[model samples]
Target: MDCTRSYWNGRKAVHRRTMMKGAGYCDSDIKTKPHIGVANTYMEGSPGTAHLRTLVEKIKQGIWAAGGIPVEFGVPATCGNVANGAEELKYEQAARDIVAASIEFVAKVHRFDGLVTVASCDNIIAGCYLAMARLNIPTLCVTGGSMTAGIYKGQKMVQAQLDVAVLGGESEEVLLELEEHVCPSFGACPSMGTANTMQMTGEIINFVVPGTGTLPSTDNLKLRRSKEAGEMIVEMTKADRKPSDLITRETLMNAIAFAMATAASTNIVLHLIAIANELGIKITLDDFDHYASKLPCIVGVIPSGPYTVVDFHYAGGALTVMKMIESQIYTNVPTMDGRTWKELLANVEAKSSDIIRTLADPLFKEPGLKILKGNLSPTGSIVRPTGVPAEMKQFSGKARVFSSDLDSFAAIERGEIVAGDVIVIRYEGCVGAPGMTELMVTTDALIAHGLHKSVGLISDARFSGFNYGAIVGHVTPEAAKGGLIALIEEGDIISVDTVQGTINLDVPENIIAERRKKWVCPPPKVKTGLLALYAKNCRTADEGGAMQPWLDDETN
Candidate 1:
């Protein structure tokens, strides 16, 4: 059972064990055991990863019992809610590359036989996968699981509602009640937001243990599964089941299809493409549109419906959704457990059709996603078609432009935005904002002001999973680079047709060309720092905004 690499054994073992003894490792522990690195993204600041400290001991016990030496390391963890707006938001995307680089460095330098990444947030999980793809090691991820929904006076409440309530200026008593019970315990927010979406993304790609992605953090099952994951990592190492062996283009597409079916998150498009980029796999916006075009939104969680991820877990988790869409997925694709996807999902069936709907009668008759392209987005833009009212889905309105998110929020607060306006928030794309922050603040503000149904918001930025209404995001070839959005002037007519899948500036071609001649790039938002580096080197949103190692032009 010696899974130790050559550098950790024989003559080199003397040097390694001599160093390990100071750390309290015995001679036997270093010589015969598999050296497994457990990268923990635990921080006390956020509920998403705060409880992972409790899981570490259980994981270590399991690793020891399974004959492996577990060595734990810490990584930075940021909460999406905490980083929602302001200067901190810019670092959110950059942190993914940081985590990937950290993991890769530690795994390579320590020469671990296997890796088990502990994460629950969106970027952390995406970073773990990217690191795994780069290292090609026997790797598995342990999601900290979702929080249980909070109950306030017989009504089930989650984080999103609390955000809306506070932003909408609810009564002080109601705000106090929500502050006391909105988050019941330690875990990611209970909705299918980016955290849960990334967890499901990892699970469907076979990077996590089956059925463990949506388990509630406080549940006894989640703790048990955390330990089980530690054991699974050891087994995977023994069998030489590397990440490259399981992660393929077919598997990535399978994960995308699952996301579409579940109405997971629009952010999955960015994360999945970034992960695929690490493996040199080209997964474009067109590929996402292709899968989303056919897959109906079957599961309803959070902003999409009244349920939470806890409900999805009780309704048979990812396995149930996979079973429902078995025809679309690569059911025979390889998984970390050495079994095909079909075999793993063989026994799973939906226990509650209310949460996970039947394929025949889905939450949305068409796909949950719509990718639009025209003058507004020459590359593309994304729209979650489900839950958008019939009247709001297709509309043409005069353009109301804002150069920044703060400006847009101020306009909404000042009562300048009207019902028949297309609120344009530009200069906030990957290169523009230097981080592409979520427009949830403005989106929620509009909803609070009773304009969610009437007004349409289009952005070069992105949205949180909880965002709803006639919102279109990820407008590519962004304004900072003189894309179509930069040419848009106040009072210009704009048209958006979800049915035809197009978002266009209704201006004549000659006028658009004339306007483009006067467009100029904005100054860098962050003149120096990690975010500045990211903004300088990052690709467009359509390409997943993955930070390039070198400029593409240099390679050319």
Candidate 2:
């Protein structure tokens, strides 16, 4: 309505008008129309983002058709799979801040009417969601869809954490064969890892249009969805519907419900907290237990079950899952379509009962997520209890200490790590590692070493969504922050009871107190640049490792 606020008369407008003219935009095209920002996180060398460059064009076409001028821009995305095994992986979490800042800068300085945030994977989507909340603009999201399952020896082979984790002990012959076939397409990992998990979370939270998350990138349906999202943002702008309108306390709870019901990534827990922090919701890790305890794990997809995200999409995507759990969701909550959740799910149903299981016959007996508190993680810790057997849920073992994932992985390869030991990887938290690196490789390595069932791993780090076993992570206050995890020593009896939701380091209370007094925080691994800045700003994993203050609890 007031498009000239950003252009047409003043000195700032003169510069904007000149730029538009230099780009060959006609007066009619540049005047009196809503200017929508298409913030695309498209990059080469990463399968997750490679296709987005082409997909953005379709979005632009839809914007033009809906009487909006599409202003396209770039955002950075890290391919966690491609950057695996190097120091580069340590900066992955830091990139989330970068992605959010870039989008916020463009939207604020340019004064766009609405925004369309597009990306795949954890940090990228989380960053965009944060930007949307920070800007509080008429906004929508389009996820780069899931990769199709690869066919290996007539069996469906998906690119999953299980595939990566097992590489540690695989024979050379098997490794050679897997390198070519594990991920043969350009999309996020086929399994329900962080990318797919975040995408589905976006849908559940109503940040994106329903049912658009898990479509295969190669499918024409994904293109149509992107185009539709572009069109929808223009309508959203017209109706004055903003991101803050859709992402609310109820919607955020609904997102947690989806994550739990699907047995989604533990990483989702971190991202969700970061997002809620941006909205000034002050969501804590303990808040998650309420939703997790109530919601049943329904969808049996990857890491947790036999199927991949493709199967989940075909079985009815996020809307279908929401429908099955409608009784649990706040149905009065609004969605991107400017309708209530009840309106959106009025006709939604699961296509197949087998893939998307019902509450009556749920996939997991307990909630997928477990928030534990004990001497080891008095601040708290997180673990995925789904897919973990009853015996592994409650166990006690001697601690086998390792300072980092690489050290533990090397020990496993050298046959030094054995069953019945609780692996402790410390100094890898948000502040400790500075980026809080994914522990998928280490978890995979242990599984490959044939000790996943017998051994348990605890860390101040995180696990990939593909990870399964008695592994517990996100322990806080982390080693660098003077948490008790840093005080743990070799052969100390470590107990983890997932059923009871407690993880403790069995030691004398006086000894632990003495250790806390004498313990000195390690020097920042990264002394300068973004990592150092992030180390200074980031809160604990229990608070979602959020750099923002609103997400943090000072009392803890």
Best by lDDT: 1
In the range 372-450, model 1's lDDT, one tens digit per residue, is: 9998998999988875667788988989999777788889888899989999998888888888877767887877888
* Candidate models: Cα lDDT each: 0.83, 0.82
The clash number for model 1 is 0
Question: How many angstroms is residue 332 displaced in model 1 relative to the true structure, after the best TM-score fit?
Answer: 1.5
Looking at model 2, report the run of 10 residues with the lowest lDDT sum: 160-169
When summed lDDT is taken over every stretch of 10 residues in candidate 1, the lowest stretch is 546-555
- Per candidate, the number of residue pairs that clash is 0, 1
| Residue 292 alpha-carbon offset, candidate 1, angstroms | 2.1
* RMSD of each candidate relative to the true structure: 1.8, 2.0
- lDDT score, candidate 2, position 432: 87
> Mind giving the per-residue lDDT tens digits that candidate 2 earns over 350-430?
554767877878977778787889888887788888857566889889999988888888888788888788999999889
Name the runs in model 2 displaced over 4 angstroms: 6-12, 161-169, 549-556
Clashing pairs in 1: none
- Candidate 1 regions off by >4 Å? 1-4, 10-15, 550-556
